[model samples]
Target chain A: MPSRDEIFEKVKTTLVDALGLDEDEVNGSSRLKADLGAESIDFLDIVFRLEKNFGIKIPRNELFPESLFTADSGFAENGRVTDKGIAELRTRLPHADKDTIEALAKDPRIENVEDLFTVNMVVNFLTAKLNG
Target chain B: MRWFWIDRFTEFKSGSHATAIKNVTLAEEHLHDHLPGFPVMPASLMLEGMAQTGGILLGESNQFAHIVILAKVPKMTFHSWACPGDSLLYSAKLIQQSDEGGMVEVKAHVGERLVAEGEIVFAHVDDAANGGAKIDQKNFVFQILRNVMDVGKAGNGTGA
Candidate 1:
């Protein structure tokens, strides 16, 4: 199994190619959307690149869950994610930064939840997938 | 005048790869105005041809169950260009797939010359939109694009 740093380096390259960012522009703290300007389509591109690069199956919505709190998801209401939604997020996204998710937990607004998915979370997810 | 970019699928392998051909002709109106004296096939249309070739491959992989939308082109490079009378060949390989979508690596070539190559990302849109609009991917795919796929049944690649 590759070490975490090796996985992070590969993931960095993947993000740079997927989002058209410079090598220096990305780091562990870079937010996929807020910092890298990733749209919904970009996530699919990222997942494709990561899967090809790392040779692992990163299931859809496993790394970057979208519409988790949609109107009919039973996890949100009036744009606010319910407590049940937050807990489910925690379970699904265990690799995400704890502090980042906690911040969202405090706010619990559906829009703010995307901020919790950072570069570190990707590294963590890959590390666990490869090393687990 | 029809929006069909690819003439026919030259090859296909469900959930694997497919190749199609496009016969660029000066008779097409767009080429006449794109560059008055130089009636070369636009790289954009070539890219679209690649997308259609790749899209059909992905759609067939799932038996056309999901509406495969070309979501993004993360990487594309034009090594050369095609012109009137050139039979451009587009080869697409399914690189990755999930319930959400699939990715394909596509390349355009004429004879032995590489015209263009790119990676296209496709997303499977749900049947119904939030506001009640709906599209049946299988039906729509068959209506406009099924002829090219039929080539797979009679020609080079595996059965559809």
Candidate 2:
């Protein structure tokens, strides 16, 4: 298994190459959408690159699972994430930053879900997948 | 008539994807017949162009080891009409593949404007084992395809 630092390096490279972002914008705290300005299509490019580089198969619903925040999903209430949603997100996205998630939970707007996906979150996810 | 649709491949990356070009001209029979004087390219032909782009990517992914055909077009949408003097650019990406068949996504562009986009599925046929004269025609089709895609007779290399 690769070290955590090694995995982060690959993750950073993948994000930079896939999104065509400056190297400085790929830091750990940078959010995929707000900080890096990643659109929905960019997610597919990122996933494709990660799969090719790491030789892993990611389900279409895993990385940026919009289904989890759908109108009928039990995770959200009134277009906002409920306490149940927050807990589920914690379990599902082990790689995401806890601090950012907590800050967003105050309002828990549906769009805030994107804020959970930080650069470090991707690094952590890859590290866990590689090790597991 | 040949099953081929794309005129030439400008870029081919073996397994990943390909970019092909088809020049629309007033000399083509379909353009004149479809409309009285407007002479716009038919949407079906544009879909065929997209399918051809995806089909080539699917076939080359496995080194032409299987006879690939456009099995189904689950979704296709056209945004604009392509007319004479318009050069269509087809960009194809492989979504997934198996021994039996594969799926691909394609987008057609006239210059910077997107003309069409869709996902296409292809199936690998074995006419040789099924025993038909079509088996011989497969060679003809592949020959024409190889010429346009700049593929080798050996079915290896990126055709760069």
DockQ of each candidate, alpha-carbon based:
0.80, 0.02
- For candidate 1 chain B, which ten residues in a row score worst on lDDT? B151-160
lDDT of 2 by residue, B1-160 (tens): 6666788787888777888898899988888887988988899888887777778788888888888776666567898888999999999988766565677789999999999998776767766424444565445454466566663344546664
Residue-wise C-alpha lDDT for candidate 1, range A30-97, written one tens digit per residue: 99999999997888889889989988887767888885776777888788888889899989889989
On the 0 to 100 scale, the lDDT of residue A54 in model 2 is 82
Candidate 2 Cα lDDT to native = 0.78
Docking class for model 2 is incorrect
Which window of ten consecutive residues has the lowest lDDT sum in model 2 chain A? Answer: A40-49
Q: Which lDDT value does model 2 have at B78?
A: 90
Could you give candidate 2's per-residue lDDT for residues A1-132 as a string of tens digits? 899888888888888866667777788888899999887656656766677678897776576665587655789988789998999888887777888788877879888898888888888888878898
Task: Please give the CA lDDT of all the candidate structures.
Answer: 0.86, 0.78
- Residue A104's lDDT within candidate 1 is 81
